[model samples]
Target: MNEKIKNFADSISPLIFLDFLFESRKNLTRLIIYFVISLGLIITVFFMQLSYSDSSRAGVINAFFIIICTSSALIGGTYSAASITSEKEKKTLTLLRMSGISGVQIIIGKIVSGFIYMLALSLPYLVLTLLLTLFGDFNFFRLAGGLFMWAGFTFFYLAAGVLISVLFKKNASANSFFYFSMFTLHFLISLLDEWFYRPLYDYSSYKFFTNLSPIDVWVNFSSSHLYGSTYYGNDGISSLFNGTVPDYAVITLLYILFSIILTLFAANIFEKYLRWRED
Candidate 1:
């Protein structure tokens, strides 16, 4: 059992280490650009809040910041996806294959690196968001819960992106697939909501659709409107009422579950689909 655990750890470590080495290359450039853009936007929002009469200016500003973090996560996935596909293009994937690393390791490493890079690039803005919320009289637990919700969504996006990276050999092809997947998921949910969940929406149909989509689960985790969503309870920050909401402990665990499922799903596909061409 110990040996099995060690081997499993060994497989993922090199990929994680490689990410650190590769960090000096393309990721550095992305880190700089993302930081500059994110910080600049946060500052702009902060200054703009000075002119607003509403004391809830902090809520408005934090919402704006959270939106930016969400956007950064999306963009981060794109960059991470592109990074892997570009390696495939450069023929380095073959070398990694020959080096005794499995596809699982490669994918896991890529996910870890991408997640870390994103956390690093966005942490400052996130801290700033929290700090402003603190001064702005926002609920501490609420703000913290929202950030955890964001991380869950981030993992989902990153896994989907890595899956796309593995499936497509070209950068454009991979990106196109990513966007198509995004659109399809969004479009289907929209249809379900408008046609089924709207005026006369039924609980049965809502459960069916939401079950198939962790994205909906993610949406329910963040949006107060969606907390009482038909399928799931918004017990966390998603709770609409001023009742006793669940703490970050519960929210974080749920998010981690979603992230683990997505990551494992990606790894499974990477092993099942790509092994042939890679070998």
Candidate 2:
């Protein structure tokens, strides 16, 4: 038992160390750039639009920007997958493979690096959201809820992107595939909501659509002001968008489960064909 425990710890240590080293080497600069640019744009827009806005509408806009920042972090994982593919293209994957690093270690190390970098990139946005709470429109509970939802949903999307990268030979192809998958998901949901949900729920169309979109879970959850309001959009499964907060625990659990299952799935596929893939 002791030997098993030690072996497990030994196994994880190198991946964690590699993840940290890689993050320190490359991702710090990337995080700094993303944070500076995104925060600057958001702050500038908020101030520029402050004088023209009504308070209620301004709060909604703030929430929207917060969601955008959180959602954009999903791209970090996609970028990390491309970085792995680039290494594969350069034949460096062989070195890593030969170094006694298990396939699980490789995938998880890369995923952790990407996750850490994304959280760093998104810290500025979280701070900004906290600052908004001081204005009375945003509360602590709401802010926390939003962050939880955002991170959870981002995990799901990030896993999807990584899965695509594992399946594709080229980084460019992986990126295109991920984007196409995202677009198709949103489009199909929107179309189904518009064409089917609206006709069924009348005012309940919003809840159905939001439930379908794991991404919207946090955005809608923070929108206490939107509760009890009627959603007129054409979508199926009404009852969630009338400003009612869905079961956040269930949604969050679903997101976590989604990430784990997909990551395992990607790892399985990688282990099977990773050796045979041509650079």
Q: Whose lDDT is greatest here? A: 1
- Tell me the tens digit of each residue's lDDT in model 2 across 1-279: 999868755765776677657666776787667767988866875565445434553365447545654455446656655755666677777777777766666676667666665676666666655555554354555556566666776676667777787777798888887777776665455566566656664655345555555445444454433453323223423234453434553466677888899889887887776656533
Which 10 residues in a row give candidate 2 its minimum summed lDDT? Answer: 229-238
- Angstrom error of the Cα, residue 66, model 2: value is 3.6
Model 2 alpha-carbon drift over 4 Å, by segment: 1-65, 68-74, 134-138, 193-210, 214-219, 225-249, 275-279
Residue-level lDDT of model 1, residues 205-261, one tens digit each, is: 444343334444434444432232222342233233344444332444555687677
Residue 167, model 1: lDDT of 72
Model 1 misses residue 132 by how many Å? 1.1
How do the predictions measure up, each by TM-score?
0.70, 0.70
| True-vs-predicted CA distance for residue 139, candidate 2, Å | 2.8
